[model samples]
Target: MRKPQVHWDDVEIGGELAGFDIEIKPRRVFLQISGSQDWYPVHHDPAFARKGGHEDIFMNTGFTQAALVRMITDWMGDGGFLRKLYFEMRRQQRPGDTMACRGKVTDRYRKDGEGWVEVDVWAENEREGVTSPGRAWVILPMRESS
Candidate 1:
């Protein structure tokens, strides 16, 4: 589905992007593991996770990265193209935890005639202050050029 377009001229540096909250469930964790072909038992088996010293089954880094990317693109809409995404996994996200994904536009500029915005993004849980911290570069289409 095409999302509402966010024009380059309308963006603001230091502006907060739309954020989302999600409750991580065991089913969702399993789905992510199956979809991503991540067959590691730590992602889907709580017993295995406990053996590894974690409280329970936790999300994989690859899945977490994909979710962060979704958070950015979903807010930027269809007109925004993700140029780069980098993140560090600070903490493990477990089932029954609510994760808040948020972002802020840090910088905006024109590069090679294309408008770009650099965003600082993160996912925080009630227990873990920050689970994943990352940055992304997105290209937003200009209204005049579109």
Candidate 2:
């Protein structure tokens, strides 16, 4: 059976969007950057990253941000538009580290005839180290409307 879609009015303050847990790997990072045509050597070259003061190549921050959007949009389904996104990089994610993305709705309201939900988002590594924290605003459909 198909699951129900989330309606704008149905998302409450403090509602949580359970996110996917991911492990960072060199190959995956390489593929992501390559596929996106973001060919910064620091994202794919360990030696270069070491010269850059990192133990190894780091995951692209853009990919991480995209993942954050995917997390909330996946829950909101197809009827939502990402309105605003802002983030701060707190720590580096090295290869082999597991990270979890989490989001919590902070407010839900209508503005300019659009249903909007503001959320606080966070990403943490397996050691409970916060890598990036951010805020997102999404526009969702009202109940009984697409």
Candidate 3:
């Protein structure tokens, strides 16, 4: 009695997720800074960013972290629960850059009676290649057994 919607069993190792791109604009950066209350100058002040060796104000850790979650949740849909998320930034994402969030299911298994899926995810830009690389573990709903 499996539901028609996607479930843990529906995904396979090496399966590709339908990912999305995020445009990093200055206003978006400011909004994130304000929303998170992370008043880091490197994230919002262009001069400070340059002094820190960056070309311009860049997306902060908060935004990067949230972007990863958004990509995974969007792929797994409403029934999934994100259990663990880990990532590192390799390059700065600045205004005018487009972050393409992509992922592949690296593994899937049942653990503690919960269906878990592991994905290798990355955010890339044309200029910086893979600016962020990470992995995430999510608990997706299992199909009911009849």
Candidate 4:
């Protein structure tokens, strides 16, 4: 199914973007690791994760990064183009945790005739608080020029 496009003129600075929730399960972790070709034991082996001082098997940073990007692009839909994305891992997202991916439009502007929105994004879990915090820039097609 095709998602509706969010035009640049429809975006408002400080507006809230649609958010999503995902459960971080062992199977999910395994799939992400496998897909990303990240074979780190801490991402799938509970015992190894615990040995590394984590409470349980945790999602890998790369997976979290990709997930966050997905969150932004998914919300922006087809008309949006990702220009830049950056994030920092603050906490571990373990299996059995529910993560809420949220973000807001921080700024909007036109550059070189292209409209862009800057977004502040984060992923939070009940137990670990903010697991990842990041920012991104997406170009959205404009309906009209100022």
User: How close is every model to the real structure, measured as TM-score?
Assistant: 0.90, 0.89, 0.90, 0.90
Model 3: how far is 90 from its true place, Å? 1.6
Residue 38 error, candidate 1, Å? 0.9
For each of the candidates, the C-alpha root-mean-square deviation to the true structure, in angstroms, is 1.9, 2.2, 3.0, 1.6
The whole-model lDDT of each prediction reads: 0.87, 0.83, 0.87, 0.86
Off by over 4 Å in 1: none
Tell me model 3's lDDT, rounded to 2 decimals: 0.87
TM-score attained by model 3:
0.90
How would you order the candidates by lDDT, starting with the best?
1, 3, 4, 2
Model 2, range 90-120, lDDT digits (tens) per residue? 7877788887899999999889988999999
- Using lDDT as the yardstick, the better of models 1 and 4 is 1
lDDT of 2: 0.83
Question: What residue pairs clash in candidate 2, if any at all?
Answer: none
Q: In candidate 3, what are the lDDT values of residues 7-108, reduced to their tens digit?
A: 998898999877888888877887888877899898888899899887898788788888888888888887889999989988978899998889999999
Candidate 2 runs further than 4 Å off: 1-3, 144-146
Off by over 4 Å in 3: 1-5
lDDT of 4 by residue, 59-108 (tens): 87888887888888888888789999988888878878998889999999
lDDT for predicted candidate 1 compared with the true structure: 0.87
Summarize candidate 1's per-residue lDDT along 1-146 as a digit string, tens digits.
66679888889989998888878986788778776889889889889989999888888887888789878888788878999999998897888888888999999989999999999999989998899999999999997744
